[model samples]
Target: MLDNGNVVWDHSEPRRGANDGTSYLCHGHLARLREIVATTPKAVAWMREQLEPVKGDFEKTAPMKASSKLPISAAAVDAADETLGLLCSWAEYTAESIGQPAPDMSNTWKVLASADSTDGALRVQGMRSDGIATVDSVARWMLERIDVIATHEWVEDFTSELCDQRATNLARWPYEERPKPAKGIECPDCGHTTLVVFTPAFAPKYSTEPLLRNGKPVEVTETVNVYDRVINPGGSVSRSSRLVKRTKRYADGSPVLATVQRLNYAPPLLVQCRSSTCRAVVRESDWARMILQAG
Candidate 1:
């Protein structure tokens, strides 16, 4: 498993690559690489658009009823530029490592290839013999060669680096752009109203009952039952005996005749404190205790 909760492998079996003294990735990881390579170019394009000059007159000429666009600062542009540079560098490095043709340094590529200014006509590793190739084309080539690219560890590293860069760019935006938390809930640690609750969108419920077959209860075993004797005012009553059918036992010693599933109407929620001063969190395991304390 990786930091982003993506599991590269879940079985106990050793990989063939490892056995052969070389590294290899499972089919799933290759597919994941393909997905990342295929979608990253679009994200790069959007980030590039952020580098455009900000509109200066829109704010002043806008009507009072119209909503204004989010403010893009110099720092935001710098961050986007940095992310784009890193992506281009990674693409080039992958090409070099795999013995593929170095990416063609087109005008857009040259501008973003490095943070420093570059001459428009200067090309890196000479022009790609296959003609002009944009970042998207390079990415497509990578997708086609996904199987021979790198090991699982390399894939994980790639995923983390790109994801972290994207996260950094996103964090540059103001908190108002994110989901609005319930302000009425107070943070127990700071005594401030900054508790945010997140609940699972799809909560599952389960039920257990007697296991049935052909519309009848399937008896796993039988047990003998004895009726208790009762003492009368003048005489004693005799005890009675009978047999009782028993169902299979659950793992926890409970009887399970069958099973059913339903939606959990009241699912557990995670409570987090948004206060910078007191970054306390209450996980679902302790949610009940926290609620009791609050009450």
Candidate 2:
């Protein structure tokens, strides 16, 4: 995957050659390759770089899963085939002009090393030998032809072989994008999980107040103030819970979360329920951006 989420087939061992390597239209060895491209395939670069934080974070434990693959359209295949045909014609014509026989289009050969591997044997499509007298010429021809073929593939899909096209600016979505609240927030008072919502009116508030204990008004500053916005932010969140005894044996603790007060102000939260209940809110760290309906 060249950052465009397109799968890259390995050709390190020269699996594909001009004379006897797998180039389809022959023994059908290219069938698997075609099928791989046809089916939704994952990115190879993604698989190789599963280390998360992605900067090779040695301290981090969980590595990221593989990135998704982009679909390769049949139109792309058709375009590649068409371009290959034209290149073959060009090579053949040049060969004929030089008084050498044009390489037979039907002629195919297999790479000896690839034959024994469970991986299908590598094969090559032939080019007229006249214009391609030297290996360097063939390499240059291949590079140019593949570039053209890859261009068509990119146009058919956003995945491009060219770095310039492949890394399209993370195109901004013209429409408004809003994040969604997590579902099933656990109630602090009743322990019931309920869906949560938030609005600008529900944003957190602050004021100096007296909290009464035993009918005596004691001046206590409550720095941590947040509302449970939604269910546990999917994964672990460094929370604590109280142990519940079940039939005097099997038991689990009721979940409890620590409120992180802001270093500058209070409640070091990115977003909190501004609602009165302030039931429970998620810190911005746990929030995710998603396409949401307008309020």
Candidate 3:
């Protein structure tokens, strides 16, 4: 949503830089609505799997410690459901304004499935319980009918109302939350106190050590901490975290054991300047250097 208005392309005929056309306000709401509708069922399935009785569950004689985080997952599902409700309400309102028929919801349920792209335009297929097939062509309709509605005086007012609702709903989405800015820390690159530090989403943290299991060599993998000081900028040190496979060979030309490590799996901590015009970044490896330079 933070558009910096940087020109992305230049036209040769007119010799002018094209305006930035990447605003979430344009189609972000519809895209998010489709995403939530498609993924909510998966979240529901996962919740069911966690809550339902499964094989290997702890016995009544010695119950295992319950997870304290399970309720967070349930809360996330509720938030997603509420957000979807808001979006559907907005969609229904827009459909009404465009004179589109209201879909029947009496004895049937609607589910948004995979997108249909047979006719070159991308449209989400909504299956109803009563065998009625519907296509979510809001995006296509908007593109095709933009010119027709461009002159309508109510379009601006309607757009404002929709944007207000979208902003409220988007804020309620759990995954949309971002880390707060690191207070009073000047960005090394931009020299601005707008840096936000955050952990990498899915970084791996372990190396695989070879072990003998049932007379066969097996690899036992373990994970690492982001704070591990593996990167040494000074002296002779390996620079990249790419996967490395090493074999310790016997002096008589036989391999004794092997170790596999994906150093890249544990990505460096990062700090980014939130300033739109000065989006500077610094990696964990550069933190020491930046601090020394500032000192």
Candidate 4:
């Protein structure tokens, strides 16, 4: 028995010796005790029972295929199970406390921070998690829940699991900062509007910072690239590109970093597209107002 939160079986084959017993290798979360338990394993036994039901449910509903990626569903808590009760209660409590929509795919769980009415003393009064606990007094709340403590012996791993997922989220997008237009960042010389990217204040439940799922690590991605071509009246140097996958913050939100990435966006022109046959360029605001319509 490994004390860390991770659980794995020491049995190399499907069938072991008649006397092998169900003693599997297990690792607990960081907060879990470090000793390897050789006794009738609590976590391993619980996991075997828990997974059988979960796996059956997925097979019936989400049916896994060899090539298709299996989608993660919210952990199904048995209504009568006390541990699930604790996990659920905490989920609701944290949700309400988080007050923001949800974590970004980057696992960067955003909080609903209020601007200080007077001096910027932390005005966090919402029901967020203990990780972002502005008030240190209640930090042990995750462990304090009766619902969690009543669950399987592996419950202590929640903190480690939660933190690991959050770290994976950071790896997906480490550069998270409010978008601040440069000091002299006026509109470009073009009559066409320039686009400014931003991260929004709202979050959705689907936004999660995950550590790992189904034996795979999740990594968030953002990409951007451009040829710095200053458009003047002379022969214009233009480029054509395939659309690059981008982490599109809400079109109606605040902006973030402006970094170069590998992309195929059409090189934007600095001035109005004056081509007589080309009706591409329009008013800057109008250009910004256009939307990409799906065929």
Which digits, one per residue and each the tens of the lDDT, describe model 4 over residues 179-276?
A: 32222222333423332322222221232333555655444445666345555568777654454656445467533333333321111111122222
Q: Write the per-residue lDDT of candidate 2 for residues 110-203, one digit (tens) a residue.
A: 2244555687766543322221122223223332232232322222221222222112211311111122343545433334443243222122
lDDT of 3 by residue, 1-295 (tens): 2245322222222211111333222232222222333333332223223332245545654554686332334443343344334434544565667787544333223444436645566333322322211112222233233323323444444445545644554554423324457765688667778877654333334656566678778543334323323646575454344444545456796666644564322322445566655545455567657657657
lDDT-better candidate, 1 vs 4: 1
In candidate 1 the C-alpha lDDT for residue 58 amounts to 71
Question: Which ranking of candidates, highest lDDT first?
Answer: 1, 3, 2, 4
**Runs in model 3 lying further than 4 Å from the true structure:** 1-185, 201-203, 210-260, 267-270, 283-288, 291-295
- Give the worst 10-residue stretch by lDDT in candidate 2: 38-47
Query: Top model by TM-score, which number?
Result: 1
Model 1 clash pairs? 209-257, 209-258, 210-257, 210-258, 211-257, 211-258
For model 3, name the residue pairs that clash: 205-223, 205-224, 206-222, 206-223, 241-264
Error (Å) of candidate 2 at residue 79 is 0.9
Per-model lDDT: 0.51, 0.31, 0.41, 0.30
Q: Identify the candidate with maximal lDDT.
A: 1
What TM-score, computed on C-alpha atoms, does each candidate reach? Answer: 0.36, 0.17, 0.28, 0.18
Instruction: Supply candidate 4's per-residue lDDT for 211.
Output: 52
- On the 0 to 100 scale, the lDDT of residue 109 in model 4 is 25
